[model samples]
Target: MTSNAENELLERYGWPIEEMDFGREDDPDVIGCAVLEEVEGGTSGIFVVRPGLDEENRTGFAEWAVQRVGRYFEHGPEPDGWQKRSDGGWQLWVRRVEMPPI
Candidate 1:
């Protein structure tokens, strides 16, 4: 079962519940939440949540995200940091990682 916090996160991030695939490594999906800073060169970080893996192995996904997203920022949270996967859900990190280099 997904907690209220998870549901709220989904809503805030615009991630559709139907699109989430939990415990299915063959098909993985990424859900991201970002906050743009008004200041120039200011830091902006996004919390990414993924689904489609077993609870025990979900942390791996988080670690992968941290490494992939951390490249954009000068520093970021440790790779070990991650909330447990609930109801076929996991989270990743994205900071100042934008596309098209706006």
Candidate 2:
């Protein structure tokens, strides 16, 4: 589920921001959410974009985004970084963030 505000924010982007339920309905604290590519039983309904960069420079935007987001999470394993594959692909190995005990 998603809140009205989240939907509104996502609506500004249009395509690729598919209807996803991140387990946050009316919770304001659920400010950060993403539709990642590596999840099991995934949906092709999701995607990514480097809106701040030009098409030519978006080569590693996904990796960059992962490292950037890792900086703010409450808890994550060490060595959070991005890697480039030999096949001209990029991957970001992120840690499972530890959420606060509610």
Best by lDDT: 1
Return the clash pairs for model 1, or none.
21-52, 22-52, 23-52, 23-53, 24-52, 48-92
Q: For each candidate, what is the lDDT?
A: 0.38, 0.35
Best TM-score among the predictions, by candidate number:
1
lDDT of 1 by residue, 2-102 (tens): 54444553454433233232333543333333232223555333443444435433443344334444443434333434333343223443222236864
Task: Give the clash count for model 2.
Answer: 0
- The lDDT, on a scale of 0 to 1, for candidate 1 is 0.38
Model 1 spans with C-alpha error above 4 angstroms: 1-41, 51-53, 74-102
**Estimated TM-score per prediction?**
0.28, 0.23
Model 2's C-alpha root-mean-square deviation from the true structure amounts to 13.9
